[model samples]
Target: MENKDSKSEMIKSMAFRLFLDRGYDATTIRMLSRAAGVEAPSIYHYFGSKKGLFYAISESYLEDYQELLKESMKHWGADPMNQILGFVKFAVWYTMNHIDETKFYLRYRLFWPAELSEDMEKHFHKTNDQKEDLLRDAIRVCIETGSCKVDEQTAYRSLINFVDSCTFNIIFSNWRPDEQELIETWQLFYQSRIKLGKGDFEL
Candidate 1:
């Protein structure tokens, strides 16, 4: 017999897989229960309802990604270039390793969340701010070290937008060129747009 915690984990894992395979709308409780190898009521026992299961799945992604960001920050005393590269690699590995979770996050957390309550939306926004702040800190480090000359806030926002565009291409890699080529393109784009003033600019 599985422990309650084990049962809850099973429900969440099965629900996530089913969500990826069948989509959030198409995945039914019965189907999820069958995949979890438990009775339908058992799923309700653990998750309360289908909406509860969906919330668990959505929140799990945010929590896990936030944890990753926190962990990265713990070791981020390095240069901005290394920090950005490390983050890029981590993001790629994370997205590839947790494709289902990434898809759910992209769908519900990032893009479509019409059914989510305002509180839930605010929760995601707040949680996302943690990671965004970390990235900003990295850019600030660059500015302080004279490696970058852009305004901290504007540079951070631009970096995030650029990274998101790159990540979106990776997410849709089926239509994208090779990862190396994509990353190279991003490097050139960033270098040209984000000048490394190296203490030369007076303004």
Candidate 2:
């Protein structure tokens, strides 16, 4: 028998694919059970309800994403500038490898549907609090180091807007940027936006 963790993972993985392929409202509990290879009640056992499962999926993806961000920070430890660059790298890698998750994530962020329960919406926002806190600290450090001239609000909004736009050509349109091209594009954005002290910044 699969371990409890593996079983739960199977359920989440199937549910995510199914939800994206078929609209959430159209995905019945029975369909989820068939797709995940779990009994219908098992879904309820592991996740309170479909809404609860959605929350679980979002939480799982973001946790992995945040970990990637943290790992990228280890490249050149202790520098505030490295911290933000880590995220830029993470964004590029995530876009290339995690197309499905990225599409789902952008969907919710850009076009939050009415189908989402209020609790699910709040849970989504709450999960990112820690990651955002980390970035804010790094941005502050960049300011202190004279690497980022923008104020906190401008820097934060610019980053958010930056990610939103990154998905445009890659996710929503026909443009398929190779990994290297994506990296250079992000490098340019950061360099231009922050006016990098290291004039020829290359990530």
Candidate 3:
């Protein structure tokens, strides 16, 4: 018999593939148990329910992104604009590299299941709220340093709109732009929104 830790990992591996392949709503516990060669109760024992399992999968991705965000933010630059650009660059990198996870996470976030547990739902929202706060803090820093030409709110809105537009295109297109395309997009947005000079950033 598999030990508890190995069993949990086994279940999650199969569950991620199933969720990505069949989607959240269609994949049943019976199917998961069959795919993992485990009993249905084993899944409940490890994850509580389907939604809980999906949350575990999402947590894996979110935690990685959060760590990358924290580490990247620290080293991106001492300046606020660099941090903002770093944020966008990281999004592009993540979207390109983790396309499946990004799609699954975005689907779950955009169309949350009605049956999802309230705790899981709240945690997901809280995680995203913290990210938004982080971005807003960078924008606020630019306002304080007088580096940004616009108000903090406008800068934040513009940056978010740019990020969202880029994400939307990449996700819907099923792939991202090349590095130069992404860099040029960021440069254009930055000049239009924050920078007084139209010159591209050193990114």
| Candidate number achieving the greatest lDDT relative to the actual structure | 3
Model 1: residues with Cα > 4 Å off, grouped in runs: 144-146, 174-186, 196-203
TM-score of 2: 0.77
User: Model 3, range 48-140, lDDT digits (tens) per residue?
Assistant: 999889888888878887887788777787677777788888888877787788877777777766677456567687668866887888888
Relative to the unseen true structure, what is the C-alpha lDDT of residue 59 in candidate 3, on a scale of 0 to 100?
88
User: On a 0 to 100 scale, what is the lDDT of residue 72 in model 1?
Assistant: 72
What TM-score would every model get versus the actual structure?
A: 0.76, 0.77, 0.85
Model 3: lDDT to the true structure? 0.79
Better of 1 and 3 by TM-score: 3
Local accuracy of candidate 1 as per-residue lDDT tens digits, 6-118: 88888898888887777777788889989988899998887788878887877777888878876875675567766776676567667666666777677665554345556
lDDT of 2 at 24: 75
Candidate 2: what lDDT? 0.75
**Quick one: ranking by lDDT, best first?**
3, 2, 1
- Cα RMSDs of all predictions? 5.2, 4.2, 3.7
Q: Give the TM-score of candidate 3.
A: 0.85
Candidate 2 lDDT tens digits, 79-189: 766766666556666786888998877666656556674555576665468658867898898888787877887777777667657655556675566768766777787
At residue 47, candidate 1 shows an lDDT of 79
